[model samples]
Target: MANRLECVDVGTEYCPCYLAELNECIVCSQLQGKKFCDCNWKGVCVFQEFVWAGYKAKVTRSTVFTRILKKEEINEEVVILTLKVPNKLARDLNEPGAYVFVRGYFSPSFFDTPMSVMWADEIEGIIKIAIQVTGPKTKFIASAKEGEEVYLRGPYWNGMFGQRYIKGMHNSKALVVLRGIAQAPGVIVILKLIQNKNKVIVLLDKGKVQTNFIKDYIKNSDVTLVEADLLSEEGQEVLKQFIKDKKISVIYSGGSDEQHINILEYMDKYESEAYLAVSNNNKICCGEGICGSCEIEIDGQKMRTCKVQVDIRKMLERKMSRG
Candidate 1:
């Protein structure tokens, strides 16, 4: 009954810019529709990077979870929203902090948004997205409320947290820094880390009001909470000192892309691991792995941000090609 879109209808006239690539396909390039080999083109293949749009989910509850006050703007357009996914799909999402590439919903402007599956209560038939308003297409999403219809695709980009902590199992200490509501979706990843008793410190930068909502949740977790006082330099110093005192294990923060640079600065200062959760939707699309749009040079190789989501260690493994 929802406005669902089963993906990979590309190669059709309307979606000429998209392509597909993955390892398990049974068809050949000629049969599948590849005019040239990747080696001949841009050292990337279209066939092996395929991810399809899956289904549609209509808004069931569209209420202001966090009402905005003064400079606490939500998006550049309609960038952020909180919503729930269907139960059938929610069950498969055992990895809470992972990403689910939502494609079925089309705006007059943009067609896809890879939203983080904040947390899924399978029995309750709900999934939360702390959407940070990004572009014009997402602007429409900001305005949408419960009962409105939208499409979604795969629960891709889910394993980022799992892989991080599994590697951290041998870690001497774990430190986490979460920036805003934008990073709320990654809470699923953090929750799992805490449930497993992973020692990770959390630095949360939230508006005065949003911090209250999270007080209860942080108290219950293994995370060492560091709250940001945005109003005064003295308050902000708390964050600096927390970073100074706590020997950082791993760092994660979500905000504007430039903020990533700041988070990186702190990590670099302390000689710690760091990853940025970019929620402004600046450069993540083509979850297909074929589009090459999500490509960024981390260490030395061009890797897809859409397929990988936020994994700090993977970024460090590569040589810094750009900066």
Candidate 2:
């Protein structure tokens, strides 16, 4: 029997396309508008999907008792949650920048949601996640009480790259832009980056109260916090000024679509590099590439975020091509 993707669009039982990079059959990817094989044998292709080495070797689906250790309202609109999971699972998630696919009950039915692991403690078997109430599901998660039981699975996506982003901190100057609850992932990313001895500047686009809530995430005294209403003209000016003054090497940003586009545009103009995290795109259902729900348009081609390793190198290539 041949291995195949779990999506319905493909007619064949096995993926006809052979991925030269992984030397594996993959129906989830295509080349030259044909579902056969890649055209180039050398060089990493931006269009190719990336499967985590651990996930490829074996798929682990174990549900452990996830207890809510702490729940606090960061602000009127945002809440932070600390959960205690299995010791082994918590330790496995020590990779600073990875997220997990969480399954929580809202109305007696289990629905899976992806949440970035903001902080984790292997010895204590504890992990923290931030929740912005965008819908009923999020609202339920935010309202979770201490000792609440939850279920979780995964340490998916580019978590392996956390060390690289952390290593990039040697550049001295780093910038992180975060807006509202949508871009909560920036909290953990910024935290790890600052720990590596970089001079960090955080541009927070939120109200004073919400900004304070965001401030709790950045305990580093060396980080400079700039508050601006990201949706206002003044906020745009602040961003431009920050971009102008810094010889920034790495930027990590998350928020609304417009916010990311602006950051991308500025990065292009300044010739700087960045990793823009997107939490709004609903297409990502399974944290694994097995499900095709996470498919979205990237440079006019459909790609899955769960499968794609998003980094500045690939993003810059796409950005430059668009210019």
Clashing pairs in 2: 283-293, 283-294
Per-residue lDDT over 1-323 for candidate 2, one digit per residue giving the tens place of the 0 to 100 score = 22222221122211122232343323433423446553322334323423322223223444555888898886777777889877767776665456776656443434667787777778998888877677777776776688777777765544322245555557477778777664456666676677677788888876433644557768677789888887788888888777765477666666654565677677668765543443333356665454567555444545444544444334444545676
Q: Give me the candidate number with maximum TM-score.
A: 2
Q: Which candidate is the best by lDDT?
A: 2
Please report the TM-score between candidate 1 and the true structure.
Answer: 0.59
Instruction: Give each model a TM-score.
Output: 0.59, 0.72
**What is the per-residue lDDT of model 1 for residues 7-66, given as tens digits with 9 covering 90 to 100?**
222222212122222331212243135464322223223243332332111122121122
Model 2 per-residue lDDT at 299: 48
Each prediction's whole-model lDDT (CA): 0.46, 0.59
The true-versus-predicted C-alpha distance at residue 148 of model 1, in Å, is 3.2
- Ten residues in sequence with the least summed lDDT for candidate 1: 61-70
